[model samples]
Target: MRKQQRIKKNEDFQQVFKHGTSFANRQFVVYIYPKKNQTELRLGLSVSKKLGNAVKRNEIKRYVRQAIFELQSELKANVDYVIIARAGATDLNFHETKKSLQHILRIAKCLPKVRNEVK
Candidate 1:
C-alpha cells in the first residue's frame, strides 16, 4: 500500500477506535469507520510487542497487508480500517491469516457486498 493510503498517525488510529465499529475474532480485531464524501479507503495495522518480537510482528503485518492488497478492489471506499492482531495471529500461516482477516472484515461489513451472477 502507498503511504497516502495507509493511516500512519497515532491520532488517526485513535479516531477510528473512538468512533468506529469493531468485530473481533480469535486472531484479529477489525475496526471500521466510514469517511463521508471520500473516495479512497485507508488502512492501519496494529501488532503489539506482547504478541511477539519485532521479526514476528513484522511478518504478521506483512500477511495482513498482503491480504488487504489482494482484496483492495473488493473493499469499501472512503472507509478507514484498523486491524489489531491478537496473540494467536502469530501462529497462523499466510493463508490462515488471510482467511481470518477476511472473516473479520466480512463480519465488520468492511468488504463490498457480494453479487450473484445472472447467466
Candidate 2:
C-alpha cells in the first residue's frame, strides 16, 4: 500500500481507536472510522511484540498489507481502518490471513455492498 494510504501517526491511530466502531473475529480486530472529506481509505496495522519475534511480526504485517491491497476495490472509501492481529493470526498463511481479514471487514461493514443480478 502507498504511504499516503496508511495511518502512520500516533494521533491518527488514537483518533480511530477512540471514535471508530470495532469488529472482531478470532484472528483479527478491525476498527473503522469514517472520514467525511477524504476520498480515499487509509489503513493502520498493529501487531504486538507479544505476537512474535521481529521476523515473524514482519511476516504477519506483510500478509495483512497484501490482503488489504487485494481487497482495496471492495473496501469503502473515505474511511480509516486499523487492524490488530490476534495470537490466532500467526498460524495463518497468506490465503488464510486474507480470508480472516475479509471476514472481519465484512463484520465491520467496511466492504461495499454487491448488487446481485438474476440471470
Candidate 3:
C-alpha cells in the first residue's frame, strides 16, 4: 500500500476507533468510517504486543498488508479502515489469513457487492 493510502497519524486511528462502526471475525476486528467525496481507501493495521513478540506481530502485519494490497481493487473506496489482529491470527497461513480478512470485510460490508454473471 502507498504511504498516502495508510492511516499513520495517531489521531486518525483514534477517530476511527471512537466514531466508526466495527465488525469482527475470529482473526480480525475491522473499524470503518466513510470519507465523503474521496476516491480511495485508507488502511490502518494494529497488531498488539499482547498478541505476540516482535517477530510474530510483524509477521501478522505483513500478512494483513499483503492481503489488503491484493484485494484493494475490490474494496469499497472513500473510506478509512482499521484492522486489528487477534490472538488466533498467528496460527493462520497466508491463504487462511486472506480468507479470514475477506470474511471480516464481508461482515463489515467493506467489500464491493458482487454481481452474478448472466448465463
lDDT of all the models against the reference?
Answer: 0.90, 0.92, 0.91
Q: For residues 1-119, what per-residue lDDT tens digits would candidate 1 score against the true structure?
A: 77788999999999999999989999999999999987888999999999989999999999999999888988988999899999999999999998898888877776655679899
Model 1 vs. true fold: TM: 0.91
Residue 78 of model 3: what lDDT? Answer: 91
Across 1-119, the per-residue lDDT of candidate 3 in tens digits comes to 88899999999999999999999987899999998987999999999889989999999989999999999998988999999999899999999999999888887777755679999
- What tens digits encode model 2's per-residue C-alpha lDDT throughout 1-119? 89899999999999999999999999899999999999999999999999999999999999999999999998888999999999999999999999888777876777755569999
TM-score to true structure, per model: 0.91, 0.92, 0.90
* Candidate 1 Cα deviation (angstroms), residue 18: 0.7
True-vs-predicted CA distance for residue 90, candidate 1, Å: 0.5
Better of 1 and 3 by TM-score: 1
Could you tell me how far off, in angstroms, the CA of residue 32 lies in candidate 3 after the best superposition? 0.6
lDDT of 3 at 94: 91
Identify the superior model by TM-score, candidate 2 or candidate 3.
2
